[model samples]
Each structure stands twice: as structure tokens, then as C-alpha cells.
Target: MDDRVAGALSLPEDWPAHPDLSLALNRMGSFDWDLDSGLMHLDRPALDVFDLRPEEYNDRPADLGQRVPEDEGARLDTMLVQALEAGQESYGAYFRCRLRDGSLRWTHTQGFIRRDADGRPRRILGIVRDASQELADSVARQELDEERRRRTSLVQATSAALAHARTVQDVIDVLKNSRGLAHLGAANIVMGLLEAGRIHLVAEGPEGSFVPGTRYTKVDERYPMSEVLRTLTPRFIETPDDFARSYPELWGQISHLGVTSAAYLPLIAQAHPIGALGLLYDDRAVFAGDERNLLVSLSSSIAQSLQRAMLYEQEHDLAEGLQQAMLPRRIPEVPGAQVAVRYRSARLGRDIGGDWYDVIPLPGGRVGAVIGDVQGHDTHAAAVMGQLRIVLRAYAAEGHSPATVMARASVFLQELDTDRFATCIYAEADLTTGVMQMVRAGHMEPLVRDPDGSCHKLFVEGGLPLGLSAEFGSLDYPVSTVELDPGHTLVFYTDGLVELPDTDLDGGMRLLTEMVRNGPQDIRRLADQLCESVDGYGGEDDVAVLLLRRDAVPSPQPGGRLRQHVAQNDPEALSSARHMIRAAVRAWGAGERADEIELTADELITNALLHTDGGAIVTIRILAGGERRLRVDVEDRSSALPRRRDAGDAGVSGRGLMLVDRLADVWGVESRGGGKCVWSEFLIPERFERPGRHEPPAHHELPDRRDRGGRDRGGRDRGGRGGAGRERPGGDGAPREP
Candidate 1:
């Protein structure tokens, strides 16, 4: 007791001499493995670390499987193998250990690799310890870091969604529908916009949570939203009692909703409060510091989006109103045909377009159909469209030819102060005669639907668009005369109808053609069908459509007449003239004399074009006298009279005067204005004048009106006019077809 240092130590019976005493105190143990023999040894402390008694584990590490989970043991083996193969000096890992109670506990093992002098791994020395206490402390920190990451992700997701919101309502929808508020433990949301010193509630929390008097509340009112808006600061309610005490007026109504807590944040943008947002939680009673900060940041993002959306909607409304006002108010009912028109605005905000359609009633039983789109998608485009529409209608009303109308309109657009140009297609349709004079100005081809529901596009001679034609000095839009047989439909549309993302023009056209063929027969229904089809393709651009279908049976009383302008060398114009005559004859019940009348009319038209320097204008009408004769007149600008002439039998020449005199009951020539009218007539039966039936006689298969008399429309030259059919003059009768 007196003195030696060894004698002064206080040791237990298992202390100083026990090798594992120090390791057991620290819950650590050692291990030794013989790699070549595949055997391992664990000291008493190591065996305790694995929760195995002395008899439970043998020298083999595999015997420790009763305490160490199979997966953990395999992981330890893999770690040792990798360490030995690399000649690593150390390795460590934490794995689950099975305890005596069948509960798994975390355990860690660190090993040191022992190598032979030649560098071969001979064995591993290591220590094993229980890591449950070490890992428990870190678990709390991990949870905190994970929460921070989730909140950051929440802000990013919400901002991304708000960035696409284009209206105030859109911002509300994102909050309600995108689960942005749900992540914050908010069962529902309430939002209010500040307007005119008042709070206008845009969203009233969850379903059936609307407060009776809170929809419109004053800034001084006893409401949470109003309080936040007035103070421009966020308010956090800790509990239902806190909400009830702070604002008893509002809490009384929402108390039944089981809202235990809430956070009302002022929506401030650029230092100005524009609105307020309320996040109501049905279960939670308090908001953490991080939750409060996150909600504040989200409020800032929502404020910015709401302000942007509000501005966008305001501008969109003004521009859309301007566009609608500029367009035609209504389409009038056209005689002898069914007409339909439609328009759809674009999907983007403030992208109002200049697409427009109009139906103008013209003189002489004719009507003007117009479909056009100006160059842009803005207010300026709408203004230009309005001006162009007015001036165009004025020119057409003045009885100008289709080509002249388009040319003058082009010049007008060129004179306007705007740099925009418009693509337009103008058609002057003679409903009674089944004829149309089409002029295209840098626009898409018009589609024609046959009686059998076949669709095809017309390739008319085209000039530059409205403003461009005058700029390029190419105002001569040649006229393409088209024949619309009874029961046929003419379709005019802006490019929007045939446009789709990632599709070429031809593909779009094919899709449109197929839809038109299968669409409803009625013009009104067909127009609706086409508009519905546009919705499927994502209508990024505005569209305007016009459909005109000729009456199946054109039955006009007496005084029904049709006229066409024939160009000097344009076969289409000439053929159109013939169809005009043919349709008039059959429509007015002169089918019996159709052959005789058609021959006489052709001879006179050929004479007018060949003998004169200019083209001729042909007019056919049913004379309303007791005789009920059908009259035909071909007028030219030349004042010279047509004199009867003779041709030899071998002549490809003028017996036209003799043939007309034979076929027509009366034929004559007279000078009028600065020109002369070569006239012919055939007396139709009295029974035909009454026309008890709507259709022509069945025996006569009406010939093709496009190209008749073995003459093609594309031919540029014809034999001399000295043929046997040539005419100089004849008796007092006009040439026409039946």
C-alpha cells in the first residue's frame, strides 16, 4: 500500500491482464484473418460486438453468419477480397448485424491489410464496433438537409410553372391544380387581388369555403387577406385560437372548415402590393421558420407572374376587340346559292391576326366572295385589313371586272402608309349562269367541290400580293374563268386553314381536301366541320373561311340573263362564255334547241374575237314575250359592221354568216355605244317558259361546257377566220346556246 506505482493501480479482476478490456470499454473489438487458409479469429470483445457467445462462432468467419446478416457478411468478404487484390493497406465499412432478439443493429469494421515481403497480401487485421449510437446522431442532421433540398425543389418547380402562366387566372390555376400549395401542408388556397382600394377575392379557398361577405372587402376590413394587403407584410396564424382572436369576423365563417393554421402573404411587385395569397392548413397549427421563408419566396414568384399575366390579358383584350370590330359584322344571304363564313382567333395572347371574310352583293345577279389575310398578327394588321376591305368592296360595287377590282385594290394598298401586304382571292360569281371570274393575288388556290363530292384546287393566273403587286409593277392579274355546275361548291380560305406545324403546304392541302370531301353537304355544317378540324392541328394562326354552293336547280323567272367577258386569245374566258350560254339555255328551258343555239353562239363569238382588236362580251337572256324566245348578243368595242361573206366549200373559212342564218330563226348586227352587237335568237316552246319542273329534259345529255366544239382551252392559235363558219353580217337575230 505504501508505494510502488503498480501497487497504486485499482484494477478489476479482468483488467490489467485482460487484453480486450480497453476495447470492450469503448465498444470496439479486433479481428485477425488468415487469407491463405480462409479462417478468421475474433477475440472475446469482437465476439461480443457481433452479439455471439464463445460457442456460437468458430474460427471460421462464416460461422459468424448466425449473428451477422448474410448480406452483411457477403459485403465484408467482397471488401476484403478487393483490398487484398489491390494490396491495399486498409479498408472499412458499416453493415447491419443480427442481434439475439432478431433485431438488426448497425456495426462497423475497419481492417488493415498485411502483406508478405514480396508484396502478396497475407492477412487482414481489423476492429469491429457497434455503430448504432454513432449513426443515430447523424440521422437528425440528414433529415434536416433533405428537408432543405425538398423546399428548394419546391420553389424551383413552382417558379417554373408560373413562368408559363399568361393570365391572372392561370396563376391561380397553377397554385390550385399543380399541387404547389399541397406541398406546404395547405389543404386549400385563397387569393385576392387589390383593385380600386378594395380586395377582390379571386380564389375562395376550397370548395364551399367561400365567405359570404369576403368576395369584395375594403382594405380596412377585418379580413386576413385585406390585413396583409394593407400592411404589405405576411401574417402567420399559429393556431385556430390565434386565427379566431386575430380576426374574429373572418374566423367565425371559416371555423367550420377545420383550418387550424394559415399564412397570408401580400403579393408585392416592384414595391407595390397587388394581391394576397392565403395557405390554409387543416391539420398543422404552426409554421416553421423554413416554412415561413419558403412561402415568402413563393409569394414573390407568384406576384411577378400575376402582374405579367394581368398585363398580357389587358393587351390581348384590346387587340382582340379591335380585330373583331374590323371584321365584317355579318354575312348576307345570297340569292340562288348557300353561303357560309367562319373565323377563329389564335391561341396566343395579343397575337390578333388580320384574317377576314366578306360577302358583297354585286349588280346583275352576281355576288363577290372575298377571303384574305394581311401580313401580320397585331393591331396594325387589323387596321390595314379594315381599310383594304372597305376600298375593295367599293371597287367591286362600282361594277369593275374581277381583275380590275384586284388591280385597283393593290394600288390602293401600295399607297397606304403601311408596309404590310395582304394575300387575297376575289371571286365574282354569276349564280344564275354557274360561272365565276377568279383573280388571285399571292393567295392559296381556291378549292372546288364537284357534285359527286370530289375536291380539286384551281391554278389561276396570279399577281403579287396587294401591296407587292403595285410595288413590283405586276398588277395584271389575269382572270381565270371557272364554271360551277349546279350542286357544286366553291371554297375560299386563308392559309391558316391548310397550315400545320412540321407539315409542308401540299400535305396540309391534302388533309383539307379529305376533310372537305367527307364533311357535311350543307355549307353551314361544312364550315363548322372545317373549323373543328383546325382545333386538332393546334391553330397557331388565325383562320377565315368562306363556302359558296350553287343551288342544285337554278330556277329564275323571266328576265334571267347571264353575261361573260371573253379575252381575245384567252381560251378560258372564251370557254367560260360558252358555258354561260349553255347553262342559261338549259336553266331557262331551251334544251330542245340546245344544239342549234350553241352552234350559232360559237360562230358569232369567233367572229368578234378574230375580226376585232379586242375581246367580246356575251349576254344571254330569256325574252319574256308571248313567243318566249331566248336571245344572245356578242358585243365588241370595234364600230365596224359585220358584213355577210361567202367561202368556197374547201374553206376552213367564213360560212359562219350562212350557218348562223340557217341555225338561228333571226340574226342581225347593230352598232351601239362605241361597239357593235351581233345578235341571234331561237324561239323556245311556250311549255318551257312555264317550266313546271326544276330540271332540264332527260333525253339530252348536256355536253361538257369547259371545252366544246373540239376546241381545247390551252390552244394559243386557231385557223384563219375565213372558214365556212365566218360571218360578216346577218338578219336581226342574236347568237346564243341552248
Candidate 2:
């Protein structure tokens, strides 16, 4: 070799090359690395392996390690040091090298360690081989494996989150907040469901991507979600241009959101497409086959879960509607008694169970409490429960005994042709006598708590459940009687109270007896505590409870009388009568019925003014007794009696008398020899009575001044006719009684 060539190659003149070694070195690139001097010499083949010119090669041996990738260079240095320390004759290393063009190439170096005279390492002579293609194939396989692992993890997390959702909104919340979707590179996630022929957006990620509940016509071809629903296929949009071309109408909106790529996958359940799932990305995204397949699989699970949640939500709403329509609006207020009722549906069922309770005010100031349960927990059972309740209420209102009401209701249920059986317990309490009569029909016995807080059950003899047999005439439900003394309580309930899953009838009854014995004194608070105590066990059946406590009777107030004066022929007395009646009823604490009483008084007063020469005298008497009565009387000098006339719908005048008859509990006409006094009595509801309110002074009794000709001797005309009657309003025609 010439001096310049040797200098460029960094080679010595005495370098030895055996034939076998020379042949091996010729095929692969050879290099000499100096251990102490830190100089390197490369052959022409070695220079070509690095893709470098001879002039570009640096003489420093450390420069070769710098040419390798940083990580590989560190590894190579470790391997060289270990080999030299072990005094090995040969050592090899494979490393990634950076070429002049800044590209990576996998290179393998095999060298022999040359030792000095003292057996210490001096230099290394090595051959370099390019392994770029082999390393590239290995790296591709590793990348594919990692991608698969990531996809699998995402799918598992998504399925788990969706599985726990119980409602449609819950599913929406999961999709919007799941970390798995974000990890999978989703910037915006939107879910649209087909509802009533329109695609409605149900859920969105990162807020503002799509408005929830925004609707689009399913038939519109420009909407991507609608298209997915129509075709039941997936769509992958690679760029904003693709979205603009496919769905021009929505492109403006999508572009404004900075969405560059999107994927719309149809969510199919039970071989039908119900909705679509959309994933959007701000940057360009390309989905590979594996990723696409993973998304499709995830969508299938999401669809089924979402469908279940939606169905549950629909059924839940329907069940609630049925319950609200059937249940009583408010419990009736019984005198000397505090009543409370509670109802709870089964926790683990799809159907709304047939549990019902009712408080009916029977005649003679008595209250009837009814509690029952149908055999099933379904919409049909609930309907039957409502119907059965109405029938029982009608029978009780007719003043039938508890046993007779049960027998009649049983026959009614059988005749209705409903394929369901019901267990019931009905009880009637006489508020005046503090006596209770109860009857059971295949139901649990009534629980009673005495004034001393001692509890016991009344094991009344009961017949078969309603609708169980056609022998209603033979079925005799025996009535059991118990005295509800002052501070005593009576409990009526269905089998759900003492038939828990974990406890038998005896055990449950004992537990209930304890709870009631130690319960709060307030009827409402006791009802709540009883329900919470028993219902904490996750009951399998619906529960219904009715609690009635007879409080100590209050002292009666003195009777109050209100009298309003009316001129013999004054038309303005009608308004004055209404005002007087309203004020009297309100002061008596019967304000809830004030409107009805005022109307009734106005009708009677107007009738007297229209038909009689002398105007009517309006008297309102508030009686304070066991059952309070509000009596309104109108006495006039007319002999004509008001008869009930069949009034047409459009005729307003004749309906006044009809309203008085319908609104008043009892009404009659009393003739005091001359004039007739028409009186109407209204039994005030117990809720209106103020317990400790003072009463007004009683009024003096007025003598009967009626004559046989229907003209009152005291109310005879004293020159108060027509114009004169209007001028002397407070004169002879004025009210005589204070």
C-alpha cells in the first residue's frame, strides 16, 4: 500500500493476514481497535459498512462507540470491558449504528483480543456485518404484540364499566368519564340512540362534543349516526376532508370542533341496530385491522348493556305511574285517632308488586282501615289490587260489618274473572266507643299495642284468599273485636310484615311485636320505624302497614251560633249571607269546607229572597260534640217548598238546589206553623278541629213565629216593600236576634 493510502486507512506496514483469516475478513468489513492508544484502523470493506468515505473516518477508537446508538454504545463498552478482564481471546457484540445520513443500521462486530507479552489485553481485530433486515423484522413483531395488549386492556375495562350500569343515564355517565376510552386515544366520544324514528344524542365525552338529547331525523342521509343506524355498519373517516365529503351538512359543525378523524360503529343488540357509537380525534388517526376489530367487539357489549339499562328505566317509570294513580291521596282524619300508613315495593324485582292500603270514612263517625296484597308482583297484579281495593271500599262505605265486607269483596273478585288471589285484612274502628272490629281473609293477624306498651296479635279466624275458590257463600270470615282504649294502638298489615325470607311467621311476628312495643309514641314516627326495622333485610315481597292510635278524647267546646240579618226584600243579602257563613265556618276551624258551606248558604238565602215577601234569616250553628256538625238554616215567610228539578247541563239556575243537596250530608225542611226553615247539616272532617280553641258564646233561642199561611207573624211586612225595603234595611226587617 502507498503511504497516503495507508495513512487514510490508519494501517501499519507489518500487519499479518493468514489466507483463511484474509478470506473471512475480505467477505466482512475488518477493523483494528487499539486498547491503550485509542486509535482505530478500518479496511475498505469496513468503511463501506458504515457508509462513510475513507477521509471521513476519524482515527480515535472512541469515535466508533459514538457512531453506535447511545444505548447500544453503553452496552458495547460493558461487554468489551468484561471480555478483557476475563482474558478471553475472542469477543463479539451487536449494536445499532447511526450512519452519515442519520439512518439506523444494525451491525454485528466479532473480534479477537490481542494480548501483550505480560498476558494483558492490548488491541482487538474485528469484522463488521450488517444485520439491519433481521432486527427490523423482530422489532415489527414486538410492536404488533404491544398493540394487541393495549387493545385487549381497553376492551376489558370498557366492558366491566358498562356491566355495572343500571340505568340509561348511568351508561351515559360511564362512557363520558371512562379513563379507558381516553387512553385509547378518543378525544370526543358520542352515543346516539334511535328513539321514535329519530336519532337522539344520549352521551358525549369532554362536554361540548355533542349536545345530549339533540335529535336528528333517522331518514336523513347526511347524518352519520343515522346512516350507521340505517345500514348497521361501521364507518371510518380518515380526515376532515373525508367527513366533509360524506356528510356535508355536519362537516361545518365537526370541523369547528377541530375533529380531523372519526369512527362511527353501529351498536347492535339481539340482531337489531338500536344506536351508534362515535369516536373522534383531533389529530389524524388511522385505525388498523386489529384496532377496528377490537372496537367492533367493544360496541357489541356496550349495546347489550345500554339496551338493558334503557328497558329497566322504562319499566321503572311505568311502575311508578301505576303506583301513584292507584294509591290514596291522603288518609282520612278519624276523631280521637292518629292514623299513619306506609308501603314499600320489593327491592329485587322488575314488576311493581300489588300491595295496597286505604282509609275509608264510614257512616256514624267510624273509620275503616284496609290492607291487602295480591299473589304476584306484576302490572296485572297491581291492576287487580286497585280494582279489589275499590270494591272493598264500596262495601265498607255501605256500613257492612268487617266480615260481611270481606265475604262480599271475595265474591266480587271471583266474579271479575281476574286470575289472581289476594289476602286482606279489614278493620272498622268506632271513634266514639273506642271499639275496633277486624276480619282477616287469608292474611296475617292484626297486632295490637295496649296503653301499657304491651303487644299482642289477634289470631282471627280467616277464610280462603279472594279469587281462590268459587264458594264465596260458604266462606265465613269471623269478625274479631278489640277495644282501642285511650293511648292504645292497632296495627293492620299484610303477610309481608311477618313472612320475611330469613324469618318464619312466628319469628317475624315476635320481632314486629318488639319493634312496636319499643316504637315512638307518635303514630307516624312509629310507622316509619317499623318499616325501616323490617325492610332493612332486603325483603322479597311488598310491604303494607297501617297504624292507628286512639288518643284521649278532647273536651267539648261550647256551641257557637252565628246570625246574619236580611231585609225583607233585599237582593244584597245573598252576598252578606256568604260572607257570614264563611267567617263562621272558618272561626269554627272548618275552613277546608268553608267554600262549600258558603255556596250552600248563598243558594238558600237567594231562594228565600226570590220567592218570599220577607227575606230569609240565615243562622249558622257550629255544634261541638263527638262528631261535629255545621248546621246552616234559612227561615223565610214563604210556604213554597224547594223541589229537586232535573236540570239540563247548560241550565245554571236549577243546579243550585241540587248542589245544596249533594254537598250537605243531611238536609230537611222544618215548618214552624207559618214559615218553613230549610236546614242543611255538614259533618266536619276531624282534621279541621283545633284541639284547644275557645268557642264563642251561645245565642238565645228564637220563638217560632210562623202562621198557617206561610207568613211569619214576627216577619210580617211593616211598610218595607220594594223601594221602601231598600231604604230601611236596618229597620223592621233587620235581624231581631243578637
Candidate 3:
């Protein structure tokens, strides 16, 4: 007998059992216990039954507790309490406990009590026995009972993987990592995909176990495992010797790979075998019945995981690629501005993020910029982002204000079929006026970094995200303005970069401020730095940033600035006629064009001021083409036309129009808005001769001066003859002198 077992069988020195009682106790494996104090006095038979020593039971519950199952600790404590209270004359328990060798055995324990006349328990007796072997048999049966359940789950998972996997390669990958469905040997695992009817080896596990990229022909293959897949049943190759005996020609190939046994399970999809799972074993161990059952069960699960990932990947690629292509190829140059941007996803899943930015040129020398984030991370989100981008650009091009654009955009986005929401900031800046207009949806306030390196947020009140309010209120989003001083920077971004998990909004804003503070000055450099920093801060969503710097103003010099002429309505071939004024400016020189153009424009206005009624307003614009040339336009609000009299008979007033017609390169007039405007231009003298320079004759200095007075005089006679041309202020009289 083992010495430990013998010692445990020994009796205590003081309460040694008598020969007769020892025989009885050994036969019955009986013991006595005082539950209140947790004392156990076990007979040698009972102690030996649990492989415990006599001294271990001396007021010690540890010995019995050692046998209690970890999961049953609470139940056993309650049982002990009931026994101590004498609630029942007898009690019983059954549980697993550890033995002397650290092996566990299930024991069935029963106790009986001897009570006094008052029915109070005085003494308790118990019996214990080793039930380890019996319990093992019970567990084995229970495992068998659960086999059907596990198989069902595995099949369902595999079916799902198969249904979702779109590509052949993805199908194989899905099967590879499908866990818990089979007792697959993690070692020597390889996957072969069927592409274009050819078996191409796609993946293998246990690095270097099999030559990668190896291909094998499916035709004329004597693979019982592969053959069995056609029937959708698990195929088994019990042993290499058996395979050799059954198919000698193919035995050498299997033996060379040290294949001693194998099983091929069919990966079925929609009642068809899309592929076969070939599991190879290099040892001679026969496939255990349970393991084969487990493998078959798990095959379906592996198939399903593969299917899901593949489908997701396909949609992700298409949606994400299209979204990126729709984005601007590069930031445009706003000569005086700096720009930066960053984008990322909050989740690991496919196409879940839809964030975008755009810079557009607006009328009246302004630039429009927008940054918006879509609410989801899938193809739908990306699609919506693309749509919104297109709509915003078109609306801006149509000359809508930032606030109007956002207001209309919300309606457009809400009408989309997809369930996507967005937050955005729309801003426009008039470079000529230094005026900036901005409207924000429910988005993080943009950061403004002044030239002094001080950063502040552009927080506007009364804004909400798009797609939330059914009847989007007039994008009452406050439009804020700030002077975009030269060298100062404005940054717009999606909230993703600043939003940390569970952090307060203010804290996130502060962190973003710090990031911008530490960022580089150059737009591109700042963009890259912000991306890296936000990622480091554990940014959970896609981060997008757009930075703008107002460029320094260009110095004013000849040919550097645009020039314009303003004029007014006319009568009798109005001296400030629109066409004539435009033609004159076109012929005039670019240098000092501003002064010359303004004077010519003022003369036309003075004539109209002296002639027309109802407050005539006229404007002329000189569209400069180059350093020496320009095009001109003039407009006025008078319907009554201008008149011209003979230059020889003209007075100071008539001389003004004749002098203008003679000096300007060209002059004319046409009806405008609700009236007519006449205009003319005078060339700026290039070089004025000194007082005693002995200048050339007037006729030689200026070629005939166009002789246009005769044409105007004739036009006045014709207007007087008919009623076609409206009369001037002094139409019936001769010319007025200034």
C-alpha cells in the first residue's frame, strides 16, 4: 500500500477505534461531526476513503473544503449552517473534491443524527466514498450529449461565412480563422482556393511548413478527402499504409509530405460545395471520432466569418475609392492664404467615416471653404459625403451666401435616401473687402491662430447639425466675422481630432488649441503635424483640418491695380454714352488710367448732373487687359438721350461734349437699367513738353481729332427732324457756354 494511504489509515493515539467498531466503520465508511464548531471526528475508514490523515479532521473544515468544487463554495456553506441549526435530523450533499494526489473525485456524502428526547441533535454521523471513476463516466456522457449542440452552432457560423464571402480568396481566409468550431490542428494548416476552376494554394500556417505558392491540379486527383467533399460529408484517410494499399500510385505523394492521416471536410454553400477543407496530420494517429465531429461542426462557422469579411471588403473598396476620387485633388491657392487638412476613421470597420473639405472661388473676388463630417463609417456615409460635396459646390457657384448654402444644404441632405447626418462649417472671405462670412452647423468651432501665435475658437451661437430638424430653421446659424490680418491663420476641422472618449467638450477644445499652438506654420507641414499629434492623442474618429492664411497685400504700381470710370444718363447722343465711354477707356493707356479714367467719368457725370432729372446714377468699369490697355463699361439710370449741336456755334456747355469727343479715343451711349448713360475717356499725356519747347502745330500734334463734330451735328438735326431721339435739357435752343 502507498505510505501516505497507510498513514491516513492510522487512528489517533487517544481515541483509537476498537477492533469491532473499526471493522464496522471501515465497512460503512462512517464519521461523526459537530457542525457548529466545524469539528469532524472521522473513522479511519472515512479518512482513508478521501485519502486524508486523522489529524486533518481535528476541528478543521479545510480538509473537507478541499474536496468542495470551486463553483459550489456558496451552496456548501449554506448546507453547513442548516446542519448546525438542527433544522433537519439528517442531511446530504454531493460534490467534487480533491484527493491526496491532487486528482479530483466526486463524493456522495450523507449524515444521520442522534437526538435527545427533546428532538435536539446531539451527535451526527456521516459516510463518504471515492466516486471519481463514476463521475468521470457521467461527465463523458454529458459531453456526448452536448456534441449535437456544438455541431449545430459550427454549421450555422460556416454557412454565414460562406454567404458573405464574395471572393475566392476571402472565402478561404474566412475558414482559416473560424475558431471554436473545430479541433483543427493549429500546426501544418494550409488553405487552397478554387479560382477559375483551379486549386490555387492561398495560405498556410505554421510558418515554412509547406512551400508557399504551390499549385496543384484538381483533375485526376486521387484525394479521397477532396472526392468526399462532392457528397458534402467528412472524408477520412485513416492511415498512410491504408492509402498506399488502396491507391499505390498517389501514396508516394502523401508519404513524401509525411501525411500519416487526413480528413477533408466540405465547405458547402447554398447546397453546393464551394470548396473543401483539407486538414492533414503528419502523425499516424487516427482521427478521433469526437474530433472529426467537432471539425465538421466548425467548418460551417469558418465559412461564415470568411463570407462576412469578404463582402465588407468589397463594398468598402468601392465606396472609399469613389469618395476619395470625388475629393479635391489638391488645395487651391488663395494667394494670401495658408491651408491644411487631415482625415481618419473612428472605427476599424469598413467605410464608416465620411469627412470632406472643399475650397471654391466665389464671385466678387472671394474664396469659399467648407469642412463637413458625415455621421457613419460605412458605404452609405461615404456616398452621402460625396453627394453633399457636389451640392455645396454647385450652390456656392450660384452665388449663395455661406448661411444660405448651409441652410439649403441641410434640406438636400435630409432628402437623401441614406440615413446619414453631418456637421459642417461654411465660410467665405472677400479678398478685396477683407470681409469674412461664416456659418457653422453642429461642428467644433474653428481655431483661429493670429500672427502673434495666440489661438482662439470661432464660436458662433445658434447652430445645429444637419438632418436633425425636420423643418430646418433658417440656418439661423450666426455668421461671425473677424479681420483676416496678413500672416494670420484660420483653421477648420472635423470634431474627430479633438473628441476624446468621455472627455468634456471643453477639455477636447483645449487639447485642440494646444495641438494647433504646437503645429508648424506652413500649411502642409501643419497638416501633417496635426494628423500625427491627433493620432497620438488617441483620436477616435477621422480628423480633418483646413487652415487659411490671408496673404499680404500687393504693392500698388502701374498696371498693378484695376481702374474704373463712373458716369450718368445723357440726352442727344449723351456725352457719357456707355458704349463711347467703354471704347475710350479701351484706347486709353493703363498707366495713370485711374486718374484719367476717373476724370473722364466725372465729366460725363457732371454733364448728366447738369442735364437729367430723377437722380441719375452711372458707373463705368475699365477692365484692364495689360500695362498699356483696358476695356471699359458705363451705365446710367436715365431714359432720355443726349444731343449734340454744331461745334462752330457751341458755347461752354456744348464745348464740353465736343471737347470730350475730340480728345477721347472713342465715345458713345446706350440705354441702361431703366434709363441711358453716356460716357467718354481722355488719354493721359505721356510727356508734356517744357514751356519754351517749340511744340508742333495742333493739326500735326493730333491727327484731325476724328472730325466727329460733323457726325454729332448731323445726328442732332436728324433727332430734331423726327421724334425717335428724346430731346436734351436745352434741345430747342443753341449750345450753352460754360
Candidates 1 and 3, the one with greater lDDT = 1
Candidate 2: what lDDT?
0.73
**Residue-level lDDT tens digits of model 1 in 435-504:** 6788899999888898788999877778799989899999877777777878889899888888888788
lDDT on C-alpha atoms for all candidate structures = 0.82, 0.73, 0.61
Estimate, for each residue in 1-738, the C-alpha lDDT of model 3 and write its tens digit.
688897789667757666536544444367777755657777776776667687666646566666565676678678866876855867888767677788776777787877779776767777776666667889899887876666666666666666656555656655666663233443345555445655555555344445422455462355553465546677777877777876675565445667777666666655645456667676546777767777776666555554555556666566557667767878677744656665554434464578899999765456888999989776677778888998988998887656568878888888885567798888876443334667788877777887777898776544788776435554444555445567778888887777777677789888878877877777788877877776577665766778887776532223321112222232422432333333333333333344445455556666666765543343333333332223233344555556665557544556555544444445556555676646453333444333445754342333434433433322333233112123234344322222
lDDT of 2 at 239: 82
TM-score on alpha carbons, each prediction: 0.83, 0.47, 0.50
Question: Lowest summed-lDDT stretch of 10 residues in model 3?
Answer: 556-565
The top-ranked prediction according to lDDT is 1
Across 1-738, the per-residue lDDT of candidate 2 in tens digits comes to: 688786788555546765435544554678888978888888777777777677777777655654677788788889988998998999887787888888888888899999989999888888887777667888899988886887787788888999888777888778768887776677868888888777777665445555423555564556778888878889999888889999887776546788878889998999977889998888756888877898899899889998998888787778857865787878877777888999876553367788899999976466889898988888888888888999999998886667668888988888888778898888776554455566778887788888778999866667788777345455556555555667888888777777777787788888888988998878789888877765575466777889988888543243445444465544444554565566556555667666667777877777777767865677777666677888888898865666656567786566666566545555566555678777777667667443344652111122232333323244543233211111123223311111
What ranking emerges by lDDT with the best candidate at the front?
Answer: 1, 2, 3
lDDT accuracy of residue 721 in candidate 2: 21
lDDT of 2 at 55: 78
